[model samples]
Target: MTHKAIAFFDLDGTLLDDKSQVRPEIKVAMTQLKENNVLPVIATGRTEVEVAAIMKEANIDSDIIMNGAFIRVDGTVIFSDLYDKNLIEEVYSAARENNDAISFYNEKEIWCNEHNKFLLGAYNFIHTPVPPVNPDGYLTKPVNMLLILGQDNDNYYASKFPQLNFYRNTPFSLDTVKKTVSKGIAVKILQEKLGLTKVPSYAFGDGPNDLALFEACDIKIAMGNAVASLKEQADFITKKNTEGGIVHALKHFELI
Candidate 1:
């Protein structure tokens, strides 16, 4: 509830570079923000295990992972949004028929039908290790998100399940979530829970999945290498990720 602002960063393309490493300048900037009492949170589409490693390596503690389906702060889970079982079935059926590789996300692990090109491609793109395949069926659990290795079928899913939202997060895959789920919603929840009413919110991202995140922030920053669509709506545009964009933007706003 103080004057300290909260900065949410998208991991893959905003904070991490092509090699999937956070730039030293960005890390230093975040450290400075910490000293100034500002909260720096990772808002990413990655799983908890991956996020755990990232946070440990980066020395960050809070995060909004799985594209806003999960929220963790000070090492405690404060919010989680799960998808409908019926809709999960619909996605599973469609993927099987189309020969698309699909993975389901729970709070603990990522399980897929099989290790295929599409799934591996996404892992490679994010510079993370390949996830395991567990075809044992994960329907009985609380599945928060789905990662499909295929083309966009947003319309089909939207028409079929009115409570779901879909978007292509990368060239090789699409991400699905409940209609009410998003990074923005997660941020709003965190803000309310923390009673940060007067503090400003800043978000940085570079993909279509980041659109909703942008909507939730007081200032939206688009990485220079971000998608054109995202750039159009940005409140500010900084350098490319590899060029120390995160640190550059923070300095530009004098947040650090």
Candidate 2:
């Protein structure tokens, strides 16, 4: 289907509320968007499995997940940027040295090296249960993104691995992926693959990870509760997520 316009949405603090649930108005807005021939795609730092229920609830079948390590268009997996196994092992060893746990992610599942306070906090903040423990899970599966369960030291990993990108989306963990991967890159790829390069695009976000997403879109809409950096770059600043941010922005743009 050829969409008239495309909108990329960041989940936490943008589309989903504080409790990690989608508001009823947002769901209504999504249906209205589709009815208006506007494509709504989820662009989040989360994995496919992590957002499966929410996607179904909102009737969204496309996503740029794992901060852009993977892309699924219209319920079909079209792109994936998996991590190098050796590099993942090296990072895992380093995190172990610092007593930090690492979680491995693919399209379907997430597994961590160990369950600790940081790991628990990271998942708890997202309203999800801790992934099963598997010290060598990365080697066994095609890992798309890694979560470094640590509050600080994001720069430490960046300095050590110039080949990878680290985004501290939460205070409890860092989202790690290939340096070339980002929501922006994924958006561009999606546009090209779907032959929608000339279509108007909008990106909605509230956090540091969404910065790349904003850069890739034609119109950037940041939530009122968004980080100052994102708000400064937004073409339109909508109300807080819990305050009907998604609906407000859609209405403002006449997308719904």
Candidate 3:
């Protein structure tokens, strides 16, 4: 069925609360959106495996995962962008030189080169456990994204490898993907693939990584707690996530 509209939501600080749990009111709002013929899609830096339970809980089937490296619509995988193994090795080496931990991600699992304070902090921030150690997983498994556990040096990596995009969503890690890949690109790809080109699109986000997502949509809604950069670009500013941001935005647009 064709939806009347589409809404893309960032997981952390937008759809999910500070504790990484979906709010009860947000769940009800999602149901209302579906009933009103609006499709809700998750646009996040997380992998498919990491969001499986959250998707089930929220009853959402579509996602732009891994910072746009993968896409799924209505339970079907439509796009997958895997990183070059050689480039992965180069980044790994660079991280090692900086004494940073690097993690490899596929749709099914995550493997890290080492367990360190940054790795633990990154996972803990998301309420997830640190991935098992498997330094060579990228050699055999397809890696769609790389997580570099570090606070600073984002620009260092960006300048060192001009072919990759680095987004530091949290203080503990940088989510790295191929250059030219972004949530915006994936939004367009999803729209074209699903014949949603004519559908009005809305995006909700709260971080720097979501700037691309905002640029891709017709309307951008920023949570009150969103970073100042994102808020500056938002068309509508809603309440804080903990204070019913999603539902308020939906109601403001009369979507719910």
Residue 176 alpha-carbon offset, candidate 3, angstroms: 0.3
lDDT of each: 0.83, 0.92, 0.92
What is the Cα-based lDDT of residue 249 in candidate 2? 89
Clashing pairs in model 1, backbone N/Cα/C closer than 3 A: none
Best by lDDT: 3
Q: Per-residue lDDT tens digits of candidate 2, residues 137-227?
A: 6766899999999977777888998988888888899999888999999999999999999999999999999999999999999999999
lDDT of 3 by residue, 130-174 (tens): 799988878889999999999888889999999998999888999
Model 2, 6: alpha-carbon shift in Å?
Answer: 0.2
TM-score of 1: 0.94
Ranking, lDDT, top scorer first: 3, 2, 1
Q: What is the TM-score of each candidate against the true structure?
A: 0.94, 0.98, 0.98
Quote the lDDT for 254 in model 2.
91
